[model samples]
Target: MALLWSRISSILPPNEEQFPLQFSDKVESSVVEMLKRSRRQLYCDTTSTSRMLNAQIVVDISWERLNTGTWRDVDKEWRRVYAYGCLFKVAALCRENPSEDEVLQAVRTCDMGLLMGAAIMDNILQVLVRILQSELRKTAKDEDESEHVEIKRAKIVSPHVPSIKEDLAIPRMKCPSLESFNTNHLIPLKPVILEGIVDHWPALNKHPWSIDYLRSVAGCRTVPVEVGSRYTDVDWSQTLLTVNQFIDRYILNKDQTSQDGGKPLGYLAQHQLFDQVPELKEDIRIPDYCCLCEGDEDDITVNAWFGPAGTVSPLHQDPQQNFLAQVVGSKYIRLYSPEDTDKLYPHQSQLLHNTSQVEVENPDVERFPEFAKAPYLECVLQPGDVLFIPVKHWHYVRSLEVSFSVSFWWS
Candidate 1:
């Protein structure tokens, strides 16, 4: 054993013992200035910040919860309390002291500060989701525990818009046909899909750098993930597929293989894509954010798909906030935590860093008992809808029908 250990050590190349996560003084100063500017904007356009916060959700996590019960009297307080603690502390720095005009101008001019604000709001979105889901589970559990409790039928709700085809007419839209939702759309849908600062752009004809149709047109190496397979959730031996038939025959069954309930769908693993696309580069603007670190070429090999009435994308967090825009079909998103490591059931080793450990629908508390402790927020995105995924939050996606989403990092 000693000889083997020595040989292994010898074969390993000497490298930096540790890479510190240090921010340069300039970056730190820039963050502080941006925070200040954000506060000014908050004072001027109180609702603008509010609306952005409503656009999405974020989470601040740590590996503290492992048992079924509370920890040091704080766990009983709920996860929201912990995440907000992080958000307010960060936001407060920007609001130290502000004059009315300066605050307004700062709000108007502070784009970078909005990133912090967006993150803060993202935390709120997470907390709300956790609490609401917790309450639902509590109520359900309580009802189950009770004897002879009354059960009522769920209420049906109607929509304000006549149909998907109808336009949202407003005084701002004298010509309803040309009316655009702009940013205000995310507000009404706040408790749903979008939970952070909402931004919109005219839909592009295709992904900025994705090669979506290649698999359909070419032959590529592929790995088969069969139903009931274990630890097969994220295998990425495929370089490309011959066509949709190849996926249907080989990949669809992999859904049942999971450490928790079942593995959710994932794009081609980063390693598989990166090895083939060395020309791929890190995103120049947000280099630190990409999950694959493939720069602009990530979409070339990272794209994934799902069939109708199926589940994919088990709850997991990544390094980047994905700009997940749907082009073909609709799907549902349920998100989890960055720090709630125990509940999500992270992979046992180093590769865990690259994948979320959480399972998809049909969560089984018996095996992954701690999963019941994790809180989640959900949204259903349709064609042309976009979702911004902050780093390290667990998310599960269920396809309503044949679905195609183009996911890319925004630097």
Candidate 2:
């Protein structure tokens, strides 16, 4: 069996000596084993035996041979290669449970970005999906006992009227600390980003059968491009996961808790959710694949992920630092300096200090009149862009399209 380098040759640059895969960089043990074998047994010569399926084709891809130092640039080149070979399109790939040959296949196809990000995506997806399945099973049994119980629907918080910015004053305080935000341990504020962050697990790449399974089984669909035209100019629907599947499969289960049925926010840095997911754990794996790396990760209750068309998180400050990353789509964010919290609105009720929940699109000037004077710091984060939101900085997040993201907060 000889190497099937012809098909992938176009994708690999001629210089392959600069980017040898490091053990830490490799996604799976099997792929690494095969690559190691190729060099030792056949002088890095790939063969048909290396092919995982009836596709007895192999190719030598020496990442080391490439002269480029910047992977970002290298990725741009590889993207063109995939496009030329008709292997280009946006699709999900799992990083865990990949077969030996399948792992090899990914090594053949993936460049730096996909290879790295896919691993994280695969692990997160398994946990999230598994949790959803568990929730569904619990709900199904609950339905059997009482067939007429209403299945709670996720709240559509941004459909009718645009929330108005409230007239709450930003507290005039020091640069900032948790003390300013939390009073008697009652969290005054929490930050959340609604974005789909999928990891590239081995199962997704090796098992060619997973595409339809993930798309259909998960009831995944391309997100809507427009909700009501309150977002960016790009088509964002294609990036979001079909969350309805999680509802049908997991929220309906009998073993699930009622609280679990509601919208979930943030990531859990645990792998007890799935046997396979645990095998693929990596260092610094963010729960939801989007953990806020700032200090004090635990004890911060980030309870919501709002992603409706025309949905806008009102200008408010949070107690903890925030890390917001866009996985599937994009979002437009605006922030005000802490000193100017007065220009934005601080809650008189204190219940709404951080999250005004006030309709920004439509405001009752008499009740929340101070909102009109706040200055805003705005930026839009495209896929993979991360925005760090400091505490007490009044900010608003709006979807430019059918957007998705994961946000983390720390006190």
Candidate 3:
């Protein structure tokens, strides 16, 4: 055992020591300034910063100059260096903060997990958090005042958007037959509400998924959550938090102000949550209509949409046919056919081509005059309702209450 330990120690790099090394004033100051600047850049325009955070940093290296397989080795070595580099940046940002709570928040930034997942899994994240906490306490004691003023606690304002009484021109039926729904809606790329479709699902009554029930079942489980009201917002970001932490901070901690000066809205959107929490899958049954798809019913993709009120999925279209089952609360859904693609003004970026650039509720007529001519279908999906949205049908969804929805996508 002693010989094995000695060999392992000899092979490791000096920087990979068992304990962290102390940095000189010059080194620490430079790293601190760089980290602060990086933080400002990161939040300045989150969409661009997200790309910067996750984009691979490539180093120019000629394979011709190295021996066979040596280039591969060099690539792997640099990749590992890149990962550590990200962790160091995160740690520096955390350490420079005078508030312990702010330090924790910095570590919880949505892209941080993507940037430093390997470090977190290796317990390096815990070490960094502890170091940051220690440094923050020391700084607080040394300085007579905090670096910035903290907001006083207040009541959490409701972020819910009240539903408008608009004419819903779409068809709404009570548990329509699979054949009729497929022929009348699916084949024609139309949207329809099939009420009572999910009435038998345990989630509706037999096994209700209330806040207390969710906390009791999967409280400590870590899941990725959206931190802003809508993805289209400039400040929108993602973060990994436990079910309990999400409920406490976003659901229970209403006094907290969001970056947009509104209540922070956390949403667990478009995630294969049933796969993560298998127990929850048993609560809801797959709609029989899913069998109509060309592929096997089991092959259908299932996702969970759980979030507080006001959470929105900006006007977007999915590539596959979707069965959105509303189990708890209600959501306002608006749809437009693919034929209106030109009028809707889809985003120029290929990545977001499926999404619309217009804000449906409040469109800038001068900027998007054509948008007014596009005919749209609307509906309020209540509990026990399953909405059939045909493939490539542009749709916008917004939660009206503390909501839980399950979506199934298939060809």
Candidate 4:
């Protein structure tokens, strides 16, 4: 396909204005025939052939192909490419679930983001989303009572408030050894910044983990990205996009506004991204500090945090001790001792009990007056800094720039 596209590009007019409309009718017809053959070969059940024949098409795109076209034209082609990318991803998903029934089931649960992102066609995207949603609803109605109970639990919500002072700061240290770290901080449940701990990590080098490098290697891997003011916000939601799309829309084009007028923060938070893309794991190292554990190496949970500046993690506590290794950009981290539990009011909602209700940056002090007195230790973690956060220590984190951090959690 690359070779064919290259040949086509060479014959095309160099001036963008003279180039033809982007729609390739031949390619579209060929794609349809391919889908038909795939359905026939995979599901030989004659009774279901008609439904497969009429399967709803999610992508039918037309736009200007040349660079001289308006921004709208460029955006149109972008969506077309994204839609094709998603179709390939859907095939991958189906391959993962080889059985015919399971493949169809997986497609029913696929979200709108996989079908389209920044596509400028919200009306069409809405129609596709509703189709999937309707299928999921029907599936739920057909499920047993146990499944219904589980679904209901996910919908339930309860609210609570937390308290934490905005002005306090967390403590910092420089490269404390394993022995000194355990004696001075770990055993005491103290939150301390350990600088120079990640200086040797490959991610700190100039080339491999750069934006261009990451896009080249892991670009096609689709991962869930958070889009919102913060995870705790009522409007928060998750969307799927390729790493290349993420870098293009959120990282490279940081200043441009989305269809929604607001500049929503895009966060790839707390995902075991290294597990999903092992190549990325090569860029990071498991700090020796995690070796303090008596169990096997698997006891440690490694999560990647990548996002643009302005992404916020509401005050929350984790179950295991954490070493948050900063690789790129900076983050403002604020920590409160576990002893201030009552002062730092936790949410009453079961799902968010570990999360605080207070927005640390701009607290509603009048409503949660005790928040004004709750002491918090704060620090801006720079590249190569690893912040040790003891279990159950209330911490509020916000990205100070386009940032990427690897967090190691162990019992």
Model 1 bad stretches (over 4 Å): 1-231, 234-240, 244-311, 353-358
Off by over 4 Å in 3: 1-167, 258-260
What TM-score does each of the candidates earn? 0.36, 0.35, 0.62, 0.61
Question: What shift in Å separates residue 54 of candidate 1 from its native position after superposition?
Answer: 62
Tell me how far candidate 1 lies from the true structure as C-alpha RMSD in angstroms. Answer: 25.3
Predicted structure with the largest lDDT when compared to the true one: 3
Worst 10 residues of 1 by lDDT: 150-159
Q: Write the per-residue lDDT of candidate 3 for residues 20-122, one digit (tens) a residue.
A: 3233343335443443443344333344334234322211111121223544443433333333445444533333222455444433431333332333325
The global C-alpha lDDT for each of the candidates, from Candidate 1 onward, is 0.37, 0.37, 0.63, 0.62
Predicted candidate 4 versus true structure: per-residue lDDT over 8-74, tens digit per residue:
2243245434422243454456554544443342333332333333332323232122234665545
Task: Write one digit per residue (lDDT tens) for candidate 2, span 160-274.
Answer: 3233344432222222233433431124333222233323323223332111233323232211112212222133222222334333322233334433344322111111212
Per-candidate count of clashing residue pairs (backbone under 3 Å): 23, 70, 2, 6
Instruction: Please say which candidate is ahead in TM-score: 1 or 2.
Output: 1
Whichever of 2 and 4 has more TM-score, that candidate is 4
1-411 per-residue lDDT for model 1 (tens digits): 112223222322233232111223432353333333433433344544442342112212211321235554434222332233333332322233323332222222222122112223333322322222222233332223221121111011121221221131111112112112223322122112332211222222323222233231211223222232223354523323322333433333332442244444333322222222222222112212233333464343333343323546556566654656564556767665576767777667785555555455677668788887776666666665556555555667666544556565432
Better of 2 and 4 by lDDT: 4
